[model samples]
Target: MIAERTEQADLLAGLRPDQWDAPTLCEGWRVREVVAHLTMPFRASLGRTMLDLAKARGDFNRMADTTARHDALQLSAADLLACMRQNIDHRWKPPGGGTHGALAHQVIHGLDVTVGLGLDRRVPPERVALVLTGMKPRNIKFFGTELDGLQLQATDVNWTHGTGTPVRGSAQDLLLFVCGRRLPPGRLSGTESP
Candidate 1:
């Protein structure tokens, strides 16, 4: 986990100021906004998250928009990177629970930035596995709406689980799907493809 954080920090370390304004794959989000959203996963308390969740109607976009607004106010790219460096080593979690919470935040949002930027950086296999394995429970319990009933199959790995029509693609593609990137529909195949 520490290594994953470090790797992400390294990834964010090199961005120039102009890069922050670049568009990302996350619909209308800019790269800097995504970085701000990624930088501070554990900064909020659970109560804050719950409040935000309620306001956002339990939508991830709500949570993201909450943080993005906060980031837009004061977070420069350098500040976001600094926050990652200061807090990355701390075992972090989402507002709700689990050690893997921070792991998911880092890896998934990392992809949001990297893939969104067209960086073509493949996520580390072990980190992806950590999220895939850990996220199954969370996906089922907390964010089950988006998943519906799609059996996700990763051609690049042994990931096969859940219920419904199967979607087969690269591990990264599946990762991006769950993380909410509209990766090439061509690279992905499954009943879950949306």
Candidate 2:
């Protein structure tokens, strides 16, 4: 998880200023908003997070969106990068989500920024495999991706999920798809690509 966070910080550090405003795979979030959301755990206290959640009427997604947008507007790209770099070793994890969830959060959001900017960054295969192995039904449901009759096959890795119309791509692309993200053209192929 530390390594993943460090890599993300490095990536952000190298981005051109204009790229900071680039759209990301995370819907409605530009690069700035995604970075703000990623660093929220490092900056927000548990009490403040709970207060924000209450303000959003207990909707986690609403709280996240509101916080990210506000933070993005308030913090510059350099500030967000500094926050990420300073907290690379932080062990914060989502409540009830453990270390694996922490890794997944970094990897997925990193992809959101990279893939959105059209950067060709490949997450390490082992890390992708670990996230794939740890996926649960609730995770899929949370993303609202309906895969009842669809199979996900990673052409670049020996991973397959479900059993029906095959959706083939790299493991990272498949991960994005499973997380309710739509990939750019040519990133995915098969009967039921997202």
Candidate 3:
């Protein structure tokens, strides 16, 4: 998680000021909102999270989305990056989720910005594999991946999962695809290759 956070910080550091307002794969969230979301755990205390949850009427997703939107308006790009860099080693985890979940959070959100921006940030193969292996049906559902009749095969790694129409690509690309982001076409090939 620390390594992933560091990689994200480095990427953000090189972003042009205009890029901060760029839209991300996360609907309604710009790059700055995504960064704010990434650093949210570091800034939001347990009590505050609970309060936000109440305000969201017990919807975790709503609480998260609303907080990210609110925080983005208050935080500068540089401050967001600094918070992420400083919290690289922070052990904060989601309710009932441990270290692996923390890694998934960082990796997926990192891809949210990089992949959405068309940047070449390849998450290390090992880290990608780690998250892939840990992915469960519930996780897939949470991310809204449409895998009911689709198989995902990674060309750059010895990993394959799911069934039906094959979706083949690099592990990182496959990860992004499974997380419900459509690549700009040609990055993933289906089994029948339409």
Candidate rank order under lDDT: 2, 3, 1
Which runs of model 3 end up more than 4 angstroms from their true locations?
Answer: 191-194
Would you list the clashing residue pairs of candidate 2? none
- Model 1 spans with C-alpha error above 4 angstroms: 41-64, 137-149, 163-165, 190-193
Residues 1-108 of candidate 1 have per-residue lDDT tens digits of 687778878877887777678777666778777767765464666787778878888897777787786775677777777887887678766557477777776777
Among all candidates shown, the one with the greatest lDDT: 2
* Best candidate, TM-score: 2
For residues 1-194, what per-residue lDDT tens digits would candidate 3 score against the true structure?
87888888998999999889999878788999999998999998889999999999999989999999999999999899899888888988877668888998889888889888989878998899999989888888887766778888998888999888778888988888778776767888883322
Local error of candidate 1 at 52, Å? 6.4
After the best TM-score superposition of candidate 2, give how far the Cα of residue 15 lies from its true spot, in angstroms: 0.7
Clash number by candidate, in order = 2, 0, 0
Q: Candidate 2, which segments miss by more than 4 Å at Cα? A: none
Cα lDDT of model 2 by residue, 1-194, tens digit: 98898888888999999999989999899999999999999999999999999999999999999999999999999999999999999989888779888888999999999999999889998899889889888878889988888889998788999999888889999999899888888888875445
Clashing pairs in 3: none
Tell me the TM-score of each prediction against the true structure: 0.78, 0.97, 0.95
